[model samples]
Target: QQQVKQSPQSLIVQKGGISIINCAYENTAFDYFPWYQQFPGKGPALLIAIRPDVSEKKEGRFTISFNKSAKQFSLHIMDSQPGDSATYFCAATKGYSGAGSYQLTFGKGTKLSVIP
Candidate 1:
């Protein structure tokens, strides 16, 4: 089963506009929510993250708002730019297990395009 689900397989935004992506998960054990941004020929880099303890987190132009009760989270990109065009992924982790390992479940991914 897909633990994490993302919407809008693709998105298009005008320069300086806001770009939003949403995701949902079914596992209540998930405690960590992270968003990753990836460009062509590059690995996914952590953009921002939030724990169930917090409702939101912001870093520069990027922000992550989480709703623990709804099991949902979203990424908001303020002043979207062409350089921000890439694939964004939402992920969830339950933290370390007794075996000394953790598993992360990622959404299908959303491809974002910012036009000039």
Candidate 2:
């Protein structure tokens, strides 16, 4: 069974609209959750992250709502802009691991487009 599941595979939002995506995880050991955003011909980079200990986290135009009890999390894009168009990925892993030894497990990815 897949450890993580994300849906809608793709999304479209007009500039200034809100964009949302969701995910679920089966591993309770995964205490760290992160969302990555990627543009075409580029690598995915960290956008926002939350820990099981926290219920929510926000950074600029991105927000992450985490439901620890349900083992789920979701991302919300506020004040969406055309530049926000990219692929988004939800990932989870242990919060603390040895240096240079941490790795992330990612969802297939959701492609988001913000029309200008």
Candidate 3:
């Protein structure tokens, strides 16, 4: 079974609307949650991340909402725009700094399209 699950394989949002993507993890050891945004022909780039201790984190138009008890998290795009059209991925991992090593388990991914 997949460690992380994401819903709505795809999404369509109108310009200036809000786009939401959700994910759930089965592993309680996952302490770090990160969301990645990928444009076609490019590797996924880290967009934002949150620790289990944080309830929510927002940076500019992007935000991440986390629920520790539920072992779930979601990404919210504020004022969605055509430029925001891309594939979004939610990932979880137990970050370890001792050896400077970490591994990530990613959700299948959500494709978001902002229609003008």
Candidate 4:
């Protein structure tokens, strides 16, 4: 089952414009939300994140707004540039499992392209 769904599988944005990607999840047990950014031939790195208790979190030009009741979250990139072009994945953690490991679920991913 695809617990997490992301919209706009791909996006094209102009330089200095804002890029927005949205994601929704079906599992309420998820407590931690993290967004990862990946470039070509590179591993995905943590971008920004928010917990269920917080509605929003921001770092630099990247921001994450979360809605606990709606089970949705979003990533907003301000002043998008060509360097920001890559694949972004929104993920959620379901705390610790019986196996003593955390269960993480990721969205399909969104491809972003920024043109000057």
Candidate 5:
């Protein structure tokens, strides 16, 4: 299965608190891990990503912790802010999918709310 399912669907956290969302997949062929952040109706934007080769990857207040054997990954937002309130999605692809017929498959989606 190429499907990646995300959990919680929605979350509410106070500002400056940590926000976490999780995802799991059944596909073992996937090699790339990506997390996206969306504000609204627009498309999701790449937030942080890791590869099966790496255990964890982080950028600024965002982080992606991955486990290849477990076929699981998660996104962590540190000191989350109200601006961070949006939708987050976890995605998986066969590494670069080489841009032709195949594209990244995304999770259903998870909306997060950061209260001030």
Candidate 6:
């Protein structure tokens, strides 16, 4: 299990703009970082992720930036759209399968609103 810290209780972005979310973890044991997007009445779905060794990772319009020394990471959503509006959560885990505990601790989500 890993503890996570996230910010921006909420956000509002214009259509075609960029959406940003940030998270941090103090536990060096955490090796995997992932962001999840959730819609109303639906389970959170994996959006993007990055490893501590990777400085940055991008997929489509989503990007993840990781800073190992600072134990911090952030998510950037480019070309924001109305469909992209949702609650975003940042999570961290140790990626241990042979352990007694395997869980992902998430932070208070950032509610992003993209204006049309």
lDDT of 3: 0.93
Look at candidate 4 and give me any clashing residue pairs.
Answer: none
Among all windows of 10 consecutive residues in model 2, the one with the lowest summed lDDT is 94-103
Clashes of 3: 0
Per-candidate TM vs. native?
0.94, 0.92, 0.95, 0.94, 0.92, 0.92
Candidate 2: residue 6 lDDT (0-100): 92
Candidate number with the higher lDDT (1 or 4): 1
Q: Estimate candidate 5's alpha-carbon lDDT, on a 0 to 1 scale.
A: 0.89
**Global lDDT scores for all candidate models:** 0.92, 0.89, 0.93, 0.91, 0.89, 0.89
Which regions of candidate 6 are displaced past 4 Å? 96-100
Model 3 lDDT at residue 93: 84
lDDT tens string, model 4, 1-116? 99999987999999999999999999888878889999999999999888888899999999999988888999999999999999999998876333325767999999999999
RMSD of each: 1.6, 1.8, 1.4, 1.9, 1.8, 2.0
Q: Pull out the clashing pairs in model 3.
A: none
lDDT of 5 by residue, 7-85 (tens): 9899999999999999999888887888988998888898888888889888999988898888999999999999999
lDDT of 2 by residue, 1-116 (tens): 78889977999998999999999999888878899999999998989888888898988889999998899999999999999999999998874554434578889899999998
Worst window of 10 by summed lDDT in candidate 3: 93-102
Clashing pairs in 2: none
Which is superior by lDDT, 2 or 4?
Answer: 4
Relative to the true structure, candidate 3 reaches a TM of 0.95
Q: Taking the tens digit of each residue's C-alpha lDDT, what string does model 6 give over 17-100? A: 998888988888887888999999999999988878889999999999999999999999999999999999998888744453
After aligning candidate 4 to the native by TM-score, how far in Å is the CA of 78 from where it should be? 0.6
Look at candidate 1 and give me any clashing residue pairs. Answer: none
lDDT of 3 by residue, 53-97 (tens): 889999999999999898889999999999999999999888733
Clash count, candidate 2: 0
